[model samples]
Target: MQSKTSSYLANLLQFCIDNKIHKARKILHAYLLRTNQFSNTFLVNRLIELYSKCGHPTSAHLLFDQLSARNIYTYHAVLDAYCKSNDIDNAYEVFAQMPERNSVTWNLIITALSHNGFEKKALENFYLMMMGGFVPTRFTLASVLSACGGVSDVGCGKECHGVAIKLGLEGNFFVGNALLGMYAKCGFVWEAIEIFKGLPEHNEVTFTAMMKGLMETDRIHEAFDMFKLMHRVGISIDSVSLSSVLGVCAKSSFEDFVVVNDNDRNWYNVHGKQIHGLVIKLGFERDLQLNNSLLDMYAKHGDMECAEMLFDNMSEVSVVSWNVMIGGFGQKYSKERALEYMEKMKNHGFEPNEVTYVNLLAACVKSEDVETGRQMFDDMSCPSLSSWNALLSGYSQNEHHKEAVMLFREMQFRNVQPDRTTFAIVLSSCAQMGLLDGGKQVHAALLKDVAYTDLYVASGLIGLYSKCSKIEMAKHVFDELPQYDVACWNSMIAGLSLNSLEAEAFIYFKQMLGKGMLPTEFSFATNAGTTNVSLGCQDQHCEYVKILFYNRYLAK
Candidate 1:
């Protein structure tokens, strides 16, 4: 009778596992517990697996704790539960307590760490696993490779690639794809292409990874070619790849498309529309992500008509879809239309998230509606740093320099840390208002943060000191920069010209050319304006300066 009953319950548990009948599994769990069969290790492991697979991590964990005679299978099941549920801290805790681990054990924890953004920790554990004399499986190498890519540690990733080759698993489809991804993410597009060529079979994932890598390296022409190749070679086109390709199209300017088609400024619209037509032809029109991409592409290209039409047709719209519409209209300076859409979004039961408010704030910036922007910002449950930066930037851009400085002080009083954008914007405001003391305080705060190395912030400081007749302070900041981009060089030159030191400004401009830094229109304009400052000198010397300026900058 006991044997028959055991067979019946085992079959029932298998049914629950196969069908994912959570309630039935729970009933079976109770029965096992009541009849003392819960002590049976095999039956308990299966129950734990069923619970884990069904997304009931708490129950699975409870069963794991209740088990008196746990084995490797028991630990694996519970570890999987935590990993799948993204409970990384608990997952690592379980791993730490495991009596003995196999390759599978290390793979689970490593993959979880990689997926959860602990890339460094994942790589650290991979070496520890190697030192433990546990050989990495194909899955283990793939996970470790992903961690390597996340951290952009191409050196370690190449070593892992060598390990894969030594194990004769380099050509294995899963490991090969991982290698492609790692190389591509590390900015080694050529290396990724070599792996892609060597792979015996190419799937949608493999093609998408290659396309994204190519795009990352600004090889958009090659990426689009890959997209065309995917369709020609009969590789299945998925939403992710299509969305990525559409994003590239949306962001591309006429200059970007000029190489593909000469002098065609409308190529962005044409390419976006072609992709939209392809999406419809391929029956992906109903795909929410693809539809959102279509909307974004149209919106970015300033085709609000098509964007709205596609947005209306989306059967299932996510918050991202709503945000895209708002951002699209906001950027086009259609403030009223953006606000209408925000109202409509709320009516559709979507609460305005941080991104939603950020878009609205941007719209306010474009329309110069500072009051409305402030109201919208205050409405946020907890305004993010980005929200603060948006309003602060709006103030600075609109010439409300005093208001910007005041808002920045409020940001500091609230204990909200400012990022690079915050420092740059506030410093600009101080420079504009000639508030040297306030700029110094902001600069002091910036020095305590990593944003001191930022070129824009450095330039803003240069402008602040130069405007206050403190050219020495401005030059000190310029000299202290580890490297000088064109902006910093221009700032230094402008500071000398602003302080009536035209000869020094000329020397700095020549040095800028010597350093191979390209002079922009702003650099030319700054130097040209200095010609006026030298008018009181000797006529010959003034003519010499004018002739030099006209020849060097105005002629161009």
Candidate 2:
């Protein structure tokens, strides 16, 4: 026969199910004091599960400790409670002591490991589960696949995919979606696309995965097309999907590709304006990210007016929005407007980040406003290397080579370690001034600091040596570079030509072309004229020189 304590406990369990958790807990506490027979294993586990489900793991743990006898269910309930509470360490400790473990127990531990950034450990446990002769379920496979995706481990992802196929879980929607996401994020774009196409019924998640994969691979046209396909098929695009496609549009709308001829220099305004219209029509203009993207699109396209309009109209501006506007005008050579906006940004209560300072310094450099640049530099609470590089490059471009070199020395005195850009600007200035001693000091500092091995720094060193009329030193630096990019090769070739090593420049140019690296217009013009003059054809050389000079004039 049921006692009063049993009836009261049953009522408390019913109260918990009916969402009266506080009342249920109160009644349970009253019954515990009213009767000693209520302290049973079943009653305690039920209460623990209730507390765990209600998002109170500490209460669940306290109840578990009060139990006189512990079972596998008791351990599992508390371990799951710890997992839900994001206390994986305590969960693992409990798992370590459970003498009797089941498949559910293993799954709980694996999930805890996966969610806590222990992807490799999670995969290892999944393998352990399989070797222990337990058949993997959809939940187990989904969790492991998610871990693979998080780490972008393609080989491990492929192995998991094979396991899923063998277990006949590949066709399951949740498992299939996880596989698609894993392959997409791992850069297997084609494989992800194939899987997406093979789905018998594609959901919103399926479309989003394919679109994101295409965008990541820089297939922007295909991503946009897939977005249209989603609309045509009546699949509603969520905020994530819309945001992803808009990001692609924003990127493509601002990216300026260099063309060899003046006529081929296509402006980005049309695409940028279209995207802006679409953003407005879609009512995403108020979104901070979309507004920031629109500002970037206009700034990059040299539409300062549109950028300013968008920036001013933004109801809620982020630091990024201000940075993009300042940077956009800076890129378009509107130095005054850039600086003004930066000042206004501060007035509007936006504290300038590192990016803001970098953009402002770049504008000061473009305008050759050294005094203003110096003032800004000195005013910085803590300037980064990028800010220093901008000022130095500006000084170099304005023919203030000595000042730029002096600034490098000052930076060294301040213990601000120079990065590759720092080395590039200072070396460029040293080359312009023929400061062999200063250049050598910088080289020594680079060796000591151990961050100057990048190709840009090596290229700058070569240019410095060539300008200082140390062709042998330039060649030595070029030889020591770990890898040569197009810019590096161009700098070396130009350096050789500038120092009157026309034959060597021609040879390097040929090597660069053979490696499928296209020469810039300046490189071609400079090298062709130099080679012609060196070959003793004065009139032909002069003719090519005239054409080169005229081309430069027109480019400006």
Best by lDDT: 1
Highest TM-score: give the candidate number: 1
lDDT per residue for candidate 1 within 1-556, as digits (tens), equals 8778888887888788899887887788889979989768888998999999899888899999999999999999999999999999889999999999999999999999999999999999999999999989999999899999999999999999999998999999999999999999999999999999999999988999998888888887888888889989999998888998887787776666533446653334666778888888888989988998888888887778888988887899999999999999999988899999999999999987899899999999989998899998888878999999999988988999999999999998999999989988998889888899999899889879988988878998898899989999999999999999999988998999989898788779778988987778788778767655654553544565566657667797
Worst 10 residues of 1 by lDDT: 258-267
Q: Total backbone clashes of model 1?
A: 0
**Local distance difference test, per candidate?**
0.88, 0.79
lDDT of 2 by residue, 1-556 (tens): 5576576776677568467465466566556657674457777776777777777778788877878698988898888889988898888888888888888998898888988999988988888888888877877888888888888888888988998899988888988888888888888998998878776777888888888877787887788788779979988666566666656665553343222336866554554466567677767767887677677766766668877777778899988988998888888777888888888999999998999988988877777787788898889999998888888888888999999999999998999888887888888889888899999999999888665668878888888888888889888888887777877887888888887777677678768768877667766776666667576554655565466556656567
Q: Once all C-alphas are superposed, what RMSD does model 2 give against the true structure?
A: 7.2
Cα error of candidate 1 at position 226, Å: 2.9
RMSD of 1: 4.6
Candidate 1, lDDT over the whole model = 0.88
Q: Model 2 reaches what TM-score against the true structure?
A: 0.65
Window of ten residues with lowest summed lDDT in model 2:
252-261
